[model samples]
Target: MEHRALGRSGLWVSEVVYGNWLTHGETVDRATATACVRAALDAGITTFDTADVYALGAAEQVLGEALRGVRRDSVELATKVCLPTGDGPNDRGLSRKHVLESCHASLRRLGTDHIDLYQAHRFDPRTPLEETLVAFDDLVRAGKVRYVGVSEWTAAQIAEALALADEWGLARRIVSNQPQYNMLWRVIEPEVLPLCRREGIGQIVFQPLAQGVLTGKYQPGAAPPVGSRGAGFGRAPRFIGRVLGDAVLDRVQRLRPLADEAGVTMAQLAIAWTLATDGVSAAIIGATRPEQVTENAAAAGVRLTPDLLTEIDRTLGDLVDTDPTKTADMFAVKAEWARA
Candidate 1:
């Protein structure tokens, strides 16, 4: 439960944040969600990340109900907007109307008057960045949201937001960026990650385990076990095997020996390995069971050795990009590897 600063915003968050993207409302029942949140809190996790679109807001309701007994002021709540709750034209994107309305809706669902962190789920090319910044500024000025952030946003988009915020005297500042960054997905490393560090925004990474791919759950020749994320109703991304392509699976298979040597699950090794980087402020961990929560919490302090990091670099086949300057080097290497 080590606390790390969320950039220069001064909001201290636990290194291992509890994320409720799946199982909270879609697969797991309310009681189970409550137990999971309690388990995370008991393990010293203070930051909880959820999205309004997750389970179409049922996730927020469940999280709000589950955390009722806990001290609200002691916890840092982070949620997102900009995703469609319905098919309406205004139901999605970063429009000022949608941003403001969505914030209130999330507040009601989350049972909180002021969200500690409010983030845009993605870059909205339709709405002008000025409109989004002004809306976020309005929320911060009205004390509805304590801070502003973006998820899965590119470095260029984030810079544009910052510039607009500066020019408009906006009350909001981009304190953090939450992107999918795991041992398998390192696309954030080259540009977006370094840009966050340069702009004083923290990197609150999501899917640090590649949704159990790094957990060694899907054996080479065996079917996925029952009740796993891939086997549950929340099964599209992980089950589609869309993200678990051969390159990803091959790298994962290669890491088994390294994880065994470290006396840690591959999940822990991957999570700790991500945190060992320079700019990650927190790692968003999705745990369905109490034991999983406890297991991932150990990721906060575990350090990867230089030798292990080197071995991981070699096996991961250009996944973890250490140098911001050589941004496209890894991509070129991947192309060459594919050709070979």
Candidate 2:
């Protein structure tokens, strides 16, 4: 697998990260999940991303077990905070209590002493950013986390945190931002990309395939394939709804010709396209079976030429969501419950 720096930080992550957002504990059984994780490791994927909210912490447990024998120092593990893990108000948000407590819980669940990247899942409007930053700073000083990051934070919010970190002389800077970025979902392209580029923050993108819409599996004007991600299996339906429409599927179908010409699967083409975007450090992909890991991991080093990228754009014209206003507010809509 190809490796790139996590922003300007010394840490480097695999170009195509293996993520267990919807698969680990909720969708697939433990054996399947473990096999997929093994597949990722065999494919040279050194980076793995998960969240405490995923499967209500079972995902972390499964991931921890999956990496049981692997050397901890050889892999980069990332997880997130800032979502309600319980009903109590303190159970969620970026308050110091929650952040610190969540970090400890995650460490125990993930079976790791330190998280390579501990991200703020979303910008907490209720909690002060200073409190969040200070808590993250404390984690680093305490040697519980190696790096800091935020997921789905707006450019303005990221800038404010960066400025505060600078003025306060925090122990570490936010090195990464995890956002949903793909060929069909370009909402992060305009503002978030530019701001992260300027601020020296790398983007670890989630849903690089638009929740499987870009894979050309959801047929236009036809019911979704049985057991597919668009089939509303488990909690995936909540996030897959936006891209399951006939209009989007029709446009996605047009990309198969391009994929055929490029001699790559539609999924790989979609993944490679997202990796081509500016300021993207890595693209996170989820899998149910071990074979899926091998299929998606090859996109790590596949570079698309300018002509193929242009062809893809022309084929997917007007279907792409580029409006800066479309960026979801994690605190408001909750459209992306799986991630920030």
Clashes per model (N, Cα, C within 3 A) = 0, 0
The worst-scoring run of ten residues by lDDT in candidate 1 lies at 328-337
Per-residue lDDT of model 1, residues 131-235, tens digit only: 888889889989999999998787788888888888877777899998877775577777887788888899899878877878877665455678776666644
Top candidate on TM-score is 2
| Candidate lDDT (C-alpha), each | 0.82, 0.88
Q: Which candidate is the best by lDDT?
A: 2
RMSD of 1: 3.5
Root-mean-square deviation per candidate: 3.5, 3.3
Clashing residue pairs in candidate 2 are none
**Which digits, one per residue and each the tens of the lDDT, describe model 2 over residues 300-338?**
889999999999989878766676665654212223322
Candidate 1 TM-score over all chains jointly = 0.91
